[model samples]
Target: MSETIAFIGLGNMGTPIAKNLIASGYTVKLYNRSPEKVKGLVALGGHSASTIGEAVKSADIVITMLSDDHAVNAVSEEILPALKRGSIHLSMSTIKADTSKQLAEKHEARGAVYLASPVMGRPPAAEARQLFILLSGDAAAKEKVKPVLSAISQRTFDFGDAPYTSHTVKLMMNFMIFTIVELLSEVMLMAEKSGIDKNILLDTMLNTIYGAPVVKIYGPLIIKEEDNPNGFGTQLANKDLRLAQETASEVGAQLPLAEVVRTHFEAIIAAGGGKKDLPMLVSYLREQSEEVVK
Candidate 1:
């Protein structure tokens, strides 16, 4: 018989990951705070769960992909009492390392297993089942979930029994991504001020030594003044940056560039771009250009 899995938090990324699991022939019990979000999955023969507790009650595995530490904490508390003994809880959200470690211990005390398996990639990657997962937990627990993880991700990087390791790596990765966006915004602003066409500069950069897939993917949006239909919204990006900054502060690490990126995001949010796509930071950069000209 196939394993029964409970997938909670059916947001943009979670929805696709769950769809991939269902396509891969798993019995998935899907639950989302907004029940409407799970209607498509329900129509596809997946089970709709009314609550988190109801979702994992009979499942062999539980997976969560929520927004922040508070959301994860709330779901964990609500579901821990209902989870069957020995069932594994795979947390796929990018959260604070300390929070992940604490939750892992709490779940272990409840006779349940927990694994920090935050993934790297956006919605498109999730839809394609091409996410790269970073996992940290007991080897045996990791082994048990390997097949399910493989179904949704192209590769999984194991970081041993330190649950916080995976979360830390995820935050560091986001720091790099956000910093790149900041640099891209600054460079585009400079080019525009120099009478260079933004598209021309982008095309040249894409074909040169500075080119990579990230720029190739995000460059056009930055240049075209398009802001809607986000792959990842600015609010979430700002949240992740704040989490990274908090983690860095806890470890006495100096993340000067990340600090600047955080400030840029704060400016974006203050300017009412919070609901827009993250790449919309270019709009803020353009505003800065106008201010400089005046």
Candidate 2:
């Protein structure tokens, strides 16, 4: 608990993660562009900083949990100039693998280290410290951040020395989640139209086939259509999907189904569901299936 930590980007997930760090007896400096967010954490034994540089400058480790690539990149610029030698930038954002590689190179040039340690979980899971953390980068840097990782996650999967490997896995994980969302959406539509009882479909899914935790979680959400409060919003879901294809393009890989799922996301957004939770894709797909029958 001797190490000082700076947590930037106080979104849903970031807030709880930062609070857990403070609760774990680490000194936490909190920062957000909107001072209001900083205030909330400040009430919970966190120190507030008005700027990213001010938050991270003296800290032993700087953690970023921003929304996407642009936000992560903008903060990395400020972090590079202020981070001291041997310090760590624990980037927990769901960003591009290329961005992680680029950030690691820049940090190394400045005598600092970047660890692409993004996590998989919702805000509630973050609050419970049950996230599955993914880490990949320099051996020493990864070693240094072990305490911080332990404080925030139930398990850490080391993706090896290449920093980009972690992000690749993170994106692939999210892509798989979205594919489940897409599949659950379409299958639920068919089930409803075919008069398959909702409980029966869920029971069969959980018992017979496709019963991973991700499937177990979303199956009922799609059946009940419970996307309220936005566990995974459209903007971020679409951003991850887009990042998947962009990453695929970088290596000449194909993601045909991902491409189609993104189109459905676009159509949902265009129809004024931009702010809706991702499971709303079921409703979107249902409307389309109805049209085909007509």
Candidate 3:
């Protein structure tokens, strides 16, 4: 609560996380490319920064919740130069493990610590402070920041000293989710073809052994075709699948489900459904069938 926290990226997940910080009595500096996006947070006691340097230059801790590897790295360049020694940059982006490792080296060389703190949970869960954080990097830094991380997350799983391990685990976690989404899509279509409502099938699953949070959450989204662009987009979901496959190859691991999921995602993107909400993958699967059963 005492730390001056600079929060970069004000997208869906970032918004709620920053709000939580302000709610918890931290001095929060908010930065985003679209300065207008920070206004709502500003109204909530967050100070808006017109530039990345302005946000991070004096902060004791910086947190990045950017879109992808490129966006995270782009800001890292500006952040690295302006951030003071001993400051912590807690990156909560889902990115490649190698990218996290590279950032760790750069941060360490500058006498700063980089904590790979990829988080799980949708915007709603974040708003509720139910997000799970997969953390790795400096152990001392992890202890120093647990309160800050815990302020917005239900639990933080520390993966030890290697910063990139958390990102690797994040990719794995997303792969499992994508695989579940693929199964949900198929089961939904199968039920639809057999004169069963997708909603009913999902209802039964939720009451039985299949009711994990991903199942409970994505099930309804797929059934209702909730394609809100502000939620997790289809294209970014595909990018994570691709990252999972790439990370698999680096370890000489075989992921048969990844290939199948990637094929479906590519088809969805090809048909211009890339920006749709992830559960709308049902639309892609339905297009491949005899008829889109309602």
Candidate number achieving the greatest lDDT relative to the actual structure: 3
Each prediction's number of clashing residue pairs: 0, 0, 0
Per-residue lDDT of 163-182 in model 1, one digit per residue for the tens? 77999889998888888877
* Tens-digit lDDT track of model 3 for 1-294: 679999999899999999999999999999999888899999999998989999999899999999899999999999999989999999999999889989999999988999999999999999999999999999899999989988999999989999889999999999999999999999998888789977777888889869898998899888888888778787899899888899999999989999998898888888888888889888788887855344
Worst 10 residues of 2 by lDDT: 226-235
- For model 3, what is the alpha-carbon lDDT of residue 6? 98
Estimate, for each residue in 1-294, the C-alpha lDDT of model 2 and write its tens digit.
899999998888998899899999999998898889888778878999878889988999999999988999998889899898889999999988888889999999989888899999888789999999999999988888898889988999999999889898898899999998898888888888889897788888888887898887788888888776638888778889999999888899988989888999888888777778877889888888879889
For each candidate in turn, the TM-score is 0.94, 0.96, 0.96
* Residue pairs in candidate 3 whose N, alpha carbon or C atoms collide under 3 angstroms: none
Model 1 / residue 216 / CA error / Å: 2.8
